[model samples]
Target: GPAATWDAVDAYFGPLVGEDDVLAAATTRARAAGLPEIQVSPAQGRLLQLLALTAGARRVLEVGTLGGYSTIWLARALPSDGALVTCEIDAAHAAVARESLAQAGLAGVVDIVLGPAADTLRRLVDEGVEPFDLVFVDADKPSNPVYLDLAVRLSRPGTLIVVDNTVRGGAVADAASTDPNVLGVREMVDRVVADPRLDATAVQTVGSKGYDGFVLARVR
Candidate 1:
């Protein structure tokens, strides 16, 4: 019931913002290719684009690439020469995202790496790539804490980091919950508050996507 209302609100306000034909096509293609329909909502995607623009980001690191939906949104915020590196563990999902990104004309701007996210992030760190201006972590929930740690390593001072799906429909507040996802998010929250290298906060959100939230942190 509430989700329907949220969807209605999104539909009403979505037109106030611009809609991209390419984005719609990307979703359609992803569905046809049997990809999970778990990408961020349109409003969230716009928020990401705005955050990237606000940060004046030239380099963006994304820990997940699901059909490249969010990847497209983030890449659009970058300058022509800007680059985005996204990690995807599933080869099938990576192929779908690769095709979608190419259709979105962002194939050249975004690199889709197919492998375990943690290993990929570690490799990036070992390669000594330039620090990212903004980092988005949206992969496996059980690895959120690890992802946050790695994301920080890939970031420079003043870098912005966004970790999605932290709320998990409010289950994250259950200290005794046995869900690996919830426990992982709680651990991530604990780490964020304890680490002096980060200044962070979280915001709960309700929309077509439900009652999940995201953590926003800035490197100190």
Candidate 2:
């Protein structure tokens, strides 16, 4: 089974990425608090860290902060003075994430914005904050296109934008699929492809989370 194989692979290679007590604690706390276990897997979190590091990202904007698992990973990629702002609509999740981020020693570098992502993003634009070096969109899947547009608005040239859960086990290839999540991803892909200001690609991934993919775009 793919699920069993994926688990075996992760078990074998996970240690290479090394252990993370903060990440483990974040997941554990989220479970204890009865939060959804939909946070990215450890391997996926590491991939986000790698992307931020490779892009030389100093300022990051994340559209989701589920228990701060990925937030810690991304924050660790930043310099001591770098900052990250993550948006979460669920007040309970935000509360849990704040405590986890503080436990990870990232409270000084990370900011949690509570409210709908669109509203928070609009507020950021209104405040005229500096463009981010990297943006991660992992919130409501049906709003992928909107998030991508805002990611571009909040970014300068050379900024990297990563959107998770784009593939959905290859359902994106089915144009007739009526699933809002699938259609949302498809629309985002099509919009990105036709955009003149971005260069992007989609990569299918398999992990303990099963098969899915992400869109990686660089603002031009």
Candidate 3:
């Protein structure tokens, strides 16, 4: 989605609630540096925070850092001892994300693993990390199903697994769409829907992020 469209959506959604200027500046810097689109909308950020709190999430795993906008939101929901582990493939973007998270006073709560997310996740699992209270996956489109499998493995019963960009510009809705990214998303949705271990639902949303969507699932 275009930046202008995101701005327009932000405008329509009313003023951002907390540290929005910091988020916007970080997003601008990230884009100027040719980073992939990674910032979460204020509405979605708030929603993530709410979900964390509602789920009583203490140890969280985030598949993408992306200037740390969503990381800040998730970390803020944790208690004083809680922690968030976020993965980012790009060092430059990760550096910017560290700065943004520090600005939000949440740097201490987040640990950024700089590498391919799948490798990093496997390492964490191999190291015997405890089950995560929540898992947020927003990495490469083609890896959605793979990430979903990893997330489920890392979660305990009732853990929340949230996936961003499930709609893929409305491509996932059309069975005939041949776009690789869209097909990947549809396959992921179908997999999630059929998995007996998870109860899932996809919600369509429109805002500063344009007409995107997300899938929310609970490990059963």
Question: In model 2, which regions exceed 4 Å deviation?
Answer: none
TM-score of 2: 0.98
Cα lDDT over the full model 1 = 0.93
Regions of model 1 farther than 4 Å from truth: none
| Candidates sorted on lDDT, descending | 1, 2, 3
By summed lDDT, the worst window of 10 consecutive residues in model 2 runs over: 13-22
TM-score of each: 0.98, 0.98, 0.90
**Candidates' lDDT values, in order?**
0.93, 0.93, 0.86
Query: Candidate 3 on 97-200: residue-level lDDT in tens?
Result: 88878887888889999999999988887888999999999878888888888888898999999999988668788999888778778888888988999998
Task: Tell me the tens digit of each residue's lDDT in model 2 across 1-220.
Answer: 8899998998898898764888899999999999999888899999999999999899999998989999999999999889999999999999999999999999999999999999999889888899999999999999999999888999999999999999898898999999999988988988899899999988899888899988999999
lDDT per residue (tens digit) for residues 1-220 in model 1? 9999988888897976555999888889999999999999888998999999999999999998989899999999999989999999999999999998999889999999999999999999999999999999999899999999999999999999999999999899998899998988999999999999999989999888999999999999
User: How far in Å is the alpha carbon of 57 misplaced in model 3?
Assistant: 0.7
